[model samples]
Target: MKNLKLKAARAAKDLSQQDLAAAVGVTRQTIGMIEAGNYNPSLQLCIAICKTLGMTLDQLFWEE
Candidate 1:
């Protein structure tokens, strides 16, 4: 499934995929893949993304 919640949260923070990726030490394509559900990030990467987005793991990564 698509990670629309992550996309929306990123948008709400005015963060482009590049910006969020740089903040989390990944490539923009990595971020895109995550939102596209083509990649399952490592726990460390997930935590980094959550921190950069000011969100919890559940708020961003949970399927619900």
Candidate 2:
């Protein structure tokens, strides 16, 4: 499924995919793939994203 929660959180923070990717030490394409549900990041990457976004794993990655 598409990660709308993650997308919303990124937008709420006023971050583009490139910005968030830089903060989390990944490429913009990686961020795009995550949002597009074409890639599943590692736990470490997931935690890095959460920390950068000021969100918990559940808030962004957990399926409803």
Candidate 3:
């Protein structure tokens, strides 16, 4: 499934995919793929992304 929550949270924080990826030490394409559900990030990567966005793992990566 698409990670719309991640996309929305990134948007709410005024972060482009590039910005978020830079903060999380990944490529912009990685961020895009995550949002598009084409990539399944590692736990460390997920934590990095959550930290950069000021969100918890559940808030960003959990499937409801």
Candidate 4:
């Protein structure tokens, strides 16, 4: 199963799902789904998350 290290990283930074959702123009539920690995965001959404986290997609979302 894939994991959302992005969500974990965001939490480490003390960001709420609502906060990330607002920053990425997505719903809080969307962030929740992403965090739960129930949703695979589009490239645009991925980029938005990366930008908000001051990270690159490669840094945030990569298979281990």
Quality of model 4 by C-alpha lDDT: 0.86
lDDT of 1 by residue, 1-64 (tens): 8999999999999999999999999999999999999999999999999999999999999985
Candidate 3 has an lDDT of: 0.96
For the record, the alpha-carbon RMSD of candidate 3 to the native fold, in angstroms, is 0.5
**Residue 6's C-alpha lDDT in candidate 3?**
99
Q: Which stretch of 10 consecutive residues in model 2 shows the poorest summed lDDT? A: 1-10
lDDT of 2 by residue, 1-64 (tens): 8999999999999999999999999999999999999999999999999999999999999997
Off by over 4 Å in 3: none
Query: How far out, in Å, is residue 29 in model 3?
Result: 0.4
lDDT of 4 by residue, 1-64 (tens): 4456887789877999999999999999999888888899999999999999888888887876
Q: What's the count of clashing pairs in each model shown? A: 0, 0, 0, 0
Worst 10 residues of 1 by lDDT: 55-64
What shift in Å separates residue 11 of candidate 1 from its native position after superposition? 0.1
Tens-place lDDT digits, model 3, residues 11-58: 999999999999999999999999999999999999999999999999
